[model samples]
Target: MMPPVARAQAQVLPGMGDGEMTASAERQLGDTIARQIFRDNDFLDDPVLVEYIQDIWQKLLAAARLRGELTPELDERFAWTILLGRDRDINAFALPGGYMGVNTGLIAVVGSRDEMATVLGHELSHITQRHISRILSRDARNMPLMVAAMVLGMLAAAKSNSRSGSDVGQAVMMGGQAAAMQNQLNFSRDMEREADRIGFGVMTQAGYAPQGAAAMFEKLQYASRLNDNGSYPYLRSHPLTTERIADMQGRAQLKPGADAAMPLVMDHAMIASRARVLSRPGVDVLRVWVQAAGTTEFAKGSPAQQAGMLYAAALSANELKDYGVARDMAARLRERTAGNAPAARLARLLAAEIELSAGQPARAGALLDAKARDRPEMMLSAQAAIAARNPAPMVGPLRDWVATHPRDATVWRTLGMLYTAQDEPLRAIRADAEANVAILDYVAARDRFKAAQDLMRRPGAGPVDHYEASIIDTRSREVDILVREQHAEEKKAQR
Candidate 1:
């Protein structure tokens, strides 16, 4: 149960070093890690939050393409996924084939939307440059020996039950290969410089402040000094040297033209504050943040920023199960922002969630179906409905969402719950299988599909059950194929 930030570096798979891996293979690599994440982490699968981030990613990517920073050789159709890592460390990383993850702490670190975009831009650059692929491609001739060393290491660990022996084996293998193969397992200074350079241009071209990258880096630098951990996650993988910081500073000063004001997207601080709350840091740390940025004693900021702070306080209080405190904070937040604004709507949703958790389902139900003509449609409405234990209002909305977003595992899971409530067990089983498959959990998905098939074998099995069973049976076989393919890849890597 270690936080995502602490676990990230160790989670990177070793010895996938064939280098001639296709774009599709790189995509599978990302999917494999993403599945592990879905299983191990408390993923913030909020539709509103997810869609907002995706919109920003698309903008940054489009700008990169316009500037000729990205090429068609890379997978243009990379199935990009932006995962929200609920960790308190400021870090972000891109997986091969366009999967990127941002820690909540990192979101809270940046001061503006432009800075956030700068971070995303940098990750996009890494993927576009194929830095990871190039790094893994080296020493192809030595892969067999490396894999052998790793296997021996595993055997030693198994025999002695001492993990350190395995660790030593891996270190020896990687270390020797790294020394002989120019240390290509890690990103080089040139790669960092290139990403920084290209990422800066991306932000500028996307109408963000030219200095956004430098500003974000300066904040990171200051944080590095304050924390001074021997292993800052970002520094471990990214290697933020002084030269890179200065290079960004210089480039940032070179503004595009007179239209270089801060970009006016949706309330960026609001998003960051929401991320901070979702990180679920302990009460002690949350208290410190509340003091510095929360609703109380935070009068010297814009209404949006203050709303953000209140949102953080409310969410933290809710997590602590202090419903009254959450209600008060959320009320203040909703009052602070304009009625129809994103911040205001989010505040209302927070309040509703608190009410639901407080066992006031009736009150929460009212919030989910707000009758106001101007009430903005919040993604949390479906979740609120679920929390209220009332699936009636959500079925139509959830169906619509699933119809348009067939691949969203989170929604499929939610829809499955609603189906169970409605006593439609067969459909629920199918939806559950889809959810499992979305994260590439072929084993779990196949099991769920089997359960659906079993349901169809009951004495009262009808035409509809039989029809659905056929589909589920086909899906199970497809999942089996995928599972076998992954096993083949792993065995190949070992060889």
Candidate 2:
């Protein structure tokens, strides 16, 4: 029982419901927004940190698929990507499709892996439920207004120079549309509740503690309070309420796993400590934090946590070329985590990084080799290989790593850097194209691919030849199609 305008907004379009946005048009829309997001924000592209985040996302995704919360076919189509925003705000968001972003502040603020999983699960639910598309459909009659707001947002983003705390001028069409906007807000709150209900289930079903949702919200509540009287960026978008916290707590209390005392599979303390170290840009800032952590109050936390913090401090010191502090602390970390299998591996990775940073590639390579003793680890061994030498000692390992992690834009970028240093311009151009493609930067990717194609056909005594030309030609045409489609969808959205 709604008026014409509201009814037009509520009516679902063909192929836009069931929380599934698998249509080709939706996919293109997602890519466009993701491109804008990356272009306007400072993103943390550290391989190790990104790997950890991807691991948690994969776990939640597996659980959701197992429960039939998501179909395997739809899963394959979603192109689920988790990216890190360099902003200090304790916020995370789900974009148009399956694209999700977490700020460094949110990751550093979390106390446990389960809490992180809860956030990921919640965001995943938002996508799976298709709340965003539904909102657009319900308000389809307001498309012109929405488009205008988006334009203003883009202008604002440009004016702010893509800095942290930029508002993006979204929702600028408010004065005359207050009543409609209020209804929209109410609808959004309902979506939030639904996401919470399903995301909570997603967390526990994945063999994680259900209490984590409550714990994280408790932290979020305090953070919101401290942020200019509860005006945290997440609150502005998510609108946290006392009811939501109580609901999470009530549900958590009923969790059997919490009563049974389920232990965490991941070393959350170490993970959070790593997040904290990488959150700050400089070694000096980490050194100050590490020094303060040794004080009585912080020292009382836990030995594992303390070891993690020291490991972070040591890694930072290594970046500052303080080899003495880095070597000693890294050695101590290995000793402290000797009994913990996973923790020991993390410490060793830290060791490899320290040695590599100090220009001791041999020592770094030897440490990882000793761990396997004979067999090698695809995960860490390949990473160590990349850090070993310029021109890269083991191209095999890098290729293997990229094959396994095809969606990792950072790794593709690293591969490109390696090829460039080796004076392999053609390969470097292709690698850069793949990196851009992974991030859905179609225009950039297409141009790079085209450049490589042109080089392949150039009449010169160079690396690229006829066979390479054929390969490049094929890739060029494929990417050209994508670019054409991308532009078409972009034009449609604007119109």
Among all candidates shown, the one with the greatest lDDT: 1
Which residue pairs show collisions in model 1? none
Give the per-residue lDDT of model 1 (tens digit) for 379-406.
3555566665667766677667667766
Question: Which portions of model 2 show Cα errors greater than 4 Å?
Answer: 1-22, 140-187, 224-231, 260-266, 281-284, 319-321, 369-393, 420-423, 462-467
Q: Write the per-residue lDDT of candidate 2 for residues 134-243, one digit (tens) a residue.
A: 66555544444453354444445444745454343333333234445435523377788888999999988887788677778887777777764432456666767888
The global C-alpha lDDT for each of the candidates, from Candidate 1 onward, is: 0.68, 0.67
Model 1 misses residue 418 by how many Å?
0.8
For candidate 2, give the lDDT: 0.67
Give the Cα-based TM-score of candidate 1 against the true structure: 0.81
- For model 1, the local distance difference test gives 0.68
